[model samples]
Target chain A: MTRTVPTSPPMRRSTVADQIRELILSRGLRPGDALPTESVLCETLGVSRSSVREAVRTLATLDIVEVRHGHGTFVGQMSLDPMVQALVFRGVLSPGDNLRALREVVEVRMALDLAVAEKVVAAAAGETHPELRALVDEMLTHADHGETFLDADRHFHTMLLESIDNQLAGQLVGAFWDIHTAVLPRLGLALPEDLRQTSKAHGDMLAAAEGGDVAAYREAVIKHYEPLQRALDHAN
Target chain B: MTRTVPTSPPMRRSTVADQIRELILSRGLRPGDALPTESVLCETLGVSRSSVREAVRTLATLDIVEVRHGHGTFVGQMSLDPMVQALVFRGVLSPGDNLRALREVVEVRMALDLAVAEKVVAAAAGETHPELRALVDEMLTHADHGETFLDADRHFHTMLLESIDNQLAGQLVGAFWDIHTAVLPRLGLALPEDLRQTSKAHGDMLAAAEGGDVAAYREAVIKHYEPLQRALDHAN
Candidate 1:
């Protein structure tokens, strides 16, 4: 009898993995949902155990699946911290384009800043955190000293996130500033006027936040980023 | 004699490394430009070699500093792919409210989809590639076939990217999709109209591209994701 033949698929491991992922997506597998055992996957996918394991490993890296010490692999949900770090790591690899790159970073920053301010107002209805208030005062006090102004300014913007109490967001935004400040001089792009203009945005944000005027708060935040955008555009 | 014990100045490795990075960003240090070496950094920063090396390593991980095995570390250019992957990873990560996370990801997708459409039209404006046309037809035929559709669908969406002929953009977008399709379910969302709406977006995108209307192409792409935003809202 002629031996039976099968597809002899290439990249069997990847195929098995995609199949598994598809199942998870469609079936709404929870984090702990037990996948069919390794042996079962091998038999079903017509692949070896090693191939199945490799697929599982890749998913694990993405944190979409987890392999426990004693238990079998299950769906995973990792918060985005590790993933975010990975992105900045890769961002730095690009060739000399700090000027443009910084500008791009600022683009997202402006949008995020506006969103942050709006959320704070919505959540708090114009109440200000004392710390945020103090930081605002500090911004005004040090306004004439550019370096001092910038430091206090960085803290104040960060405080807005702190006021909202979204730790994940605070960290993400903070990370961006950490990077921006770190790369600023290398890009050799700065506009004192931009910083001065930014102070007004802060003032506007604070006023709107205090008044609990959601519309004004949103508009203020968006306007705040205008100078940053202009500065970035000039850098570009 | 009890020497006056002095508080050690905070390790300035990060500061030094940052300065070097600034140089890279500012265009003072072009990609592939050799760094002054451990000895040089030490002299410039008034720090120890170990500190310098640490800073270099930090930069290396940032992908800002590339250490050639023998030649030494040099200033590096930036690549958008790595940077974008980093952002998407971070964005998904440390995600706050489930709704916001989903909304943010979908919003980003909308932006990128516009970019992809524009690129596709720009690249494929004058003529069509038979391969691309075939892929679209295959996708149209396989629509609603689930597994089959998904496979062809990947190709079809990917074709828009290929139309741009920009490998880095394709890679970055591909990475986002990797994250997208992975958590497709836990995301507790899909287009309100589901695949039908997704298909409509694809069809409209292709139509705009084929007709060579850049603005219309972008508009169609932007509207295509409306279902995605609705899905997120509905889930919330």
Candidate 2:
């Protein structure tokens, strides 16, 4: 099949950044892979050293590249920090009575939990996550003491996320979790009188994991977040 | 109920950044809200001016604040540029034969698309999006001419996302889409032989939207992505 080729445009000063990004990607550079020195980049791209430095700095600010002191520039680790911060900022800035934003957050979290649950169950091969079981136990113990088990509750979900063994999944889940925690205070959410129900929901999930039932696990995960969903509905 | 409050520790330099963040949140600062001058912040927090500047600079780097050349610093708009860049970088850097990471990306995209479809269908109230109809028409026309309709394909999904009207949702879908596109070339994905199938799937989605049948809409979406999923499976 013949396709038309578009005419090429002249490279302007601003094209330097695009060129550099293409260079890095085309070279298949990974995190910690060093880029050519500024002088070399300048000579190769036929751009000034200052322009190359500026472009590199801009990339660094976006977490695309890292400049180590006393060392050369290298590809940077993928980070969810900025995304997490953006979510928190947007959540807080959402207009009054705009519960849709909150709902979207909850919806995304539930989806992620559902996906991660299936992964955790699959990874277990009909076994259960021992760390998740321990966390659930800690949650029950704290609830029995009439104390909030937020930390243990967080750990339970985090443990399941870890079993997925995907950095992207972990980062996205963690970022959304931060948004949920940040908004919880403003929602004035109180612990349900029957914290035991919360425990029971988690127990169901653990059982489903043990049975390798993905559908049941998803249902249990949804049940676990029902209280928060209810609170959000009431707020709306 | 009695709870013990921990005593405050002596002021640490590193705490200055946290204190500034707290100040911003406590004040309910929004994007474009100007922050206090460096001198004022230093005095209010009982920290040195340099420390105040350093904190502000760090925030600026994270795109949390914008320092105008002439005017003082202000809160920055919520941005997903960094997150998009991070996703693209991570997708490229993923180790060889890492089908799990690709699966996670596909899972998240499917979940998001499902949620957005429900929202779009509900919002339509039995009416279909005319813009989507136009895009689909363009897609079929292009497909008939032996051209790839990737742009129209993207617009159709993006239009659905816009109808949801949640910035967080749009940002995430765009980020995950970036990862999907970045990995597509590596997968050596080719167009499916049955262009008519692709056109029919979209037509079904449009029909579901008109009928306000969310389940049907979601099914159509899954059908739309089937080609890519098959390609990934083959690669694995």
Candidate 3:
């Protein structure tokens, strides 16, 4: 006899999870603070040990809690891992067709990059971000090296995002960047042929950042994406 | 003897899952397309039945695959459910005191809303979206109704997002909106006290959309957010 398990939902509703989450919030537990023990949670919530355990497991998966061996569970640092995973699956599971979905990711990235550029420029106020400058310098060095220079590129953007001091925006942008880098390779996509142009675009952005010019930053951002736009246009 | 069963992740890594995802992509399986039988997947992937089942469970949890009760598994529609869940948890589990996290959510929403408004104005080109018009009208009717007019507000924003024909951006905006709505109640935050001002903001946005004026739309978007900004400012 084949006993079948029911199809699970895309997102299952979890009463136990909600209760535990509430407990964390209500008690003001910090990221590293230990949650109540299983027995205590079970008794307090009037649920089974298995249910309590299940709830923590779910929270852990969502990056909301960390379960340590013997030490007990603690609240986890917030992360974009879950969002990144969702985007990866989105790209992977997309039916073979036009690169519309991947292109959408690019479009969102462009919007975010433009926003970050403006914020960075306004905040810098004619001052230089040494870190950003260093990254751009490294990018120039690696421009014609036939390598992706992905690390410097990523750090430059990440630094820009961090400078804004907005964690949520950073996570959203990081998730999309992760998706773009991950999906592009799978689709047999490569960087633009003219690497020097790419490095020059970064330089322009750096200059705009130092000059506190939002308009120049915006133009530089558009220039930076030109190669990507060209690549996407060709893919289409 | 305390033998510990490692807490299972909300999403566990599964090589079989990757293989199965690749299989779906390689086979050009669209959403709702059924997959091979359990026996076939096991045979083809050269994995144990348990591994295949576990992988499928992981995929289902990720919303990458849908499992039917007895009809076998199928590709699942791409969703922002996971991202929304992550954002919700981020809000819920935040250490109290600073609304920085919540404020960040608002800022991201503002950026996306601006983008959405621009796109809607460009696309409509002097034509009004009736659904949006109706929502604004409803807001006006409820201006003094002492209700929050939250539903109409959400619909107006959601409708604007959908009109852009970008599912990814819409899903993203929708996710942040979900996070904001879910978090605000928990924080005991309320709408601005002046209902008329709120209604007027929406009216201004509608007028801009109808008139195909991007600058006016942008101004209206900023004005519409003033209440929320004031609320956040008061909280801070």
Candidate 4:
């Protein structure tokens, strides 16, 4: 007796780009894994070379597929770069009422940070984040010199979520931070007077986490955003 | 006396796409605003038509620009569509260990919902959400019949964020929900048996919000996700 195997139809029957994505998924390809050649993909998917190339380019924009100049196509890093770009564009487009967009970004960031406060504090129990402390100290040093501590500030926020297992949340935090930095200058707003106070909030957050005080960590998170909130209000 | 005005250099001077984005920003274009013709854009940016087309395609992929078949290109909606595509692709790519991705998605959703618990409750204080109540009733009706209530579920969550003045948060919530639904079937896991209980949690959440009880609302949110968490644990 002969046996028959059943095959399901394509999950999403839309675009050539989606078909390419389906090919990637069906092949169980991981990031950095090499894909078939362009011509091979064309033959496999029954499409023209230009169609395949267009699909590839679109996928590359989404960071779903990586194209190397000398090498060949491969699975992409699958980063949140697209989200960051879209957000930055949205923030940029709303030049007149950009404060609304900026406030939304800050509010979402604050929500995410606050939601993870207890988990972050729990993860910090019996563990000392020397890197976090060092970042805070670096921030304070920059504050004392009255210079912006952008690198340290970015790293400090990134490090805060290092203990959490959720990569999406961390990437989101970083993406919002990127949007804030990218759009802030376009508003032509003045900096808050107390850079030291904002810098010290980072230290307070670290201390609260190290001490396993969720309430304090939550308070520090709010305090960290207070300066920016005030600055936004001042701009209004 | 003659005076010279200083011009700042381009912020991101890498790609033609970046140049096009800068052009859009410099012109203060809004969504649905028409862009220059292809040849005009090429001349303005001092690039070839092919280069301009490529940049436009890239921007279109990011939803920064929109292109019509016969009509000219305009600014896109700048939605979280790119993020949704990236997330859905990411979730689909990791088929073998998809539980991890699903867990992250759920965690982030829970975090956002919890983070907005108080605000959502406050927003619903004086407002009667007949739509929300109807959705809960629809969910319960579907559960009674052993059917899935996907549309009502999605609408309910989307409506929960409607009162909040954060478009990004709402879009993110919708994006994550889309990912969850898109990737869940691929896991080949059985649906949990407590459909009515899960459906009832929606009602619980609505009641808590209507009662202006933040703590109860928070509890309802946790209860809402408990079934999925248990199912995941069982799968593990």
Query: What range of 10 consecutive residues in model 3 chain A has the weakest lDDT sum?
Result: A1-10
Model 4's DockQ score: 0.37
- Candidate 4: tens digits of C-alpha lDDT, residues B1-236: 12121112212223888787878889988899999999898898899988888788888877888898699999998887777777777876675674888789889999998888877898887667898999999989999999877778888888888887777788788778777777667676556667888899999999999899999999998998888788877877
The stretch of ten residues in a row with the least summed lDDT in candidate 2 chain B is: B1-10
Q: Which candidate is the best by DockQ?
A: 4
Query: TM-scores of all models?
Result: 0.53, 0.77, 0.88, 0.91
Cα RMSD for candidate 4? 6.5
Give the distance in Å from residue B9's predicted Cα in candidate 4 to where it truly belongs: 15
Better DockQ candidate (2, 4) = 4
Q: How would you encode candidate 1's per-residue C-alpha lDDT over A108-175 as one tens digit per residue?
A: 45545654665677665635567666767666656646533556567766666676645545555665
Clashing residue pairs for model 3:
none
lDDT of 1 at B80: 33
Cα deviation at B53, candidate 2, in Å, is: 8.7
lDDT of 3 by residue, B86-203 (tens): 6676775562648777888888888987867777787767675777777888888898787677677777777777778677888888777777777776677665766777778988
Better model by TM-score: candidate 3 vs candidate 4? 4
Candidate 4 on A1-236: residue-level lDDT in tens?
12121112222213888788778878788999998999999899999999889788888888889899779999998888777787877876785874888788889999988888887888886678888888889889989999877778888888788778888888788778788777777678666667898899999998999898999999999999888889988887
Q: Give the top-scoring candidate (lDDT).
A: 4
TM-score of chain A of each: 0.55, 0.75, 0.88, 0.91
Docking class of 1: incorrect
DockQ per model, Cα: 0.08, 0.26, 0.26, 0.37
